[model samples]
Target: MKIEIAEHKKLAHSMELDVRWGDMDAMGHVNNAVYFRYMESVRVEWMRAVGCEPSPKGQGPVIVNAFCNFYRQLEYPARLLLKLYVSDPARTTFETWTTIERLDQPGVLAAAGGATVIWVDFPAQKAVPLPDWMRALVL
Candidate 1:
């Protein structure tokens, strides 16, 4: 069964993850590219939670823009707590914000960024307005 948006919506969706050795660069800090992977992981998890999956036959979400900023060096063996929220919903796209914090340090921010996600019909290769369910998930 399809679930509607919660009456009382949460500000954001979050999860905790561990920094992997492979995610680091020769400099011993998390590589610049790895932050995006972390964000992608969170987004994919959210999609599953909200019952949206990418399929060629129907409308699926795609990231049209992605960005991140490093506040500090993220090393392996550290715990990362990440949060995601939506802002500025448009007809075919919405902005998603992400906050990456080091769980061990509590309030210390490791990085932050967001992406503009566009809903599209894969077979037609064009954009489509956000579906009701998808809007609910973002809001």
Candidate 2:
């Protein structure tokens, strides 16, 4: 998706990831599934950076929607710089954009993606409105 970094919700969090050899696929590049994990790492970190504690049982945000666009091949043993910024937050859901780039090539983006996650009431197995305290963090 086309996102202007300046237009994001202004919460910024960064993380460094070491690509493991096993993270590569037979095609000789980082596996697509690994990208999701990378993104998840950033999301969790962002929430922590904003001072939101994990749910009591350790369950966190639920992914209601997600998509990624691969711009370049990411190989193993490389350092990935991940940045996450909130996009928008509704009463029950929030969105964020994540960008992963090789540290060696800061300006060259390897992948870009975003996810929409909904707060959930686990026991009820249904969506729940974000609590006021949680919404305060994003705002």
Candidate 3:
């Protein structure tokens, strides 16, 4: 059950991640839990790259939900190329999708996932409308 990525969609960000030895599990493949960490790294990096850093007293994005589908087992000593995309921007939320592929394997998909991101007022702990600049980026 691999997630489909649109062929014509523009990617939000792309980065490489090294699969560390510690990421392996007793079964000798990358642990399922570590995939979520990979997704988080890319998401946070994209947010920072776009100047969307969270401020304790200001508004920022929160991931209300997230999911991932694994199509292939990832082993250690691998470099993964992760591509991220953003879409469906609403007043306070947007969707972030990601594809993980091993650089050594090129086009082969290792996994895919996404998260529903909501803009939140940190102090108020409530949702807020996304800033114009941020909305424009996703659009």
User: Per-residue lDDT tens digits of candidate 1, residues 1-139?
Assistant: 1122233434457898899999999999999999999998887787788788788898899999999988888999999988777766689998887778888787677888788899999999999999987787666
Better-scoring candidate (TM-score), 1 or 2 = 1
Query: What are the lDDT figures for the candidates, one per model?
Result: 0.82, 0.82, 0.90
- The count of residue-pair clashes in candidate 1 stands at 0
Largest TM-score belongs to which candidate? 3
By lDDT, rank the candidates, best first.
Answer: 3, 1, 2
Model 2, global lDDT: 0.82
Q: Which stretches of candidate 1 lie over 4 Å from their true place?
A: 1-10
Candidate 2, residue 15: lDDT: 92
lDDT of 3 by residue, 24-137 (tens): 999999999999999989989998998887889999999999999899999988999998898988999999988999998888789998899999999999999999999888
lDDT of 2 by residue, 16-93 (tens): 999999999999999999999999999988788767675645435788888888989999779999998775779798
Using all chains and alpha carbons, the TM-scores for the candidates as numbered come to: 0.90, 0.87, 0.94
RMSD for all candidates, in order, please: 6.6, 2.5, 1.7
Q: Show how many residue pairs clash in every candidate, following the order shown.
A: 0, 0, 0
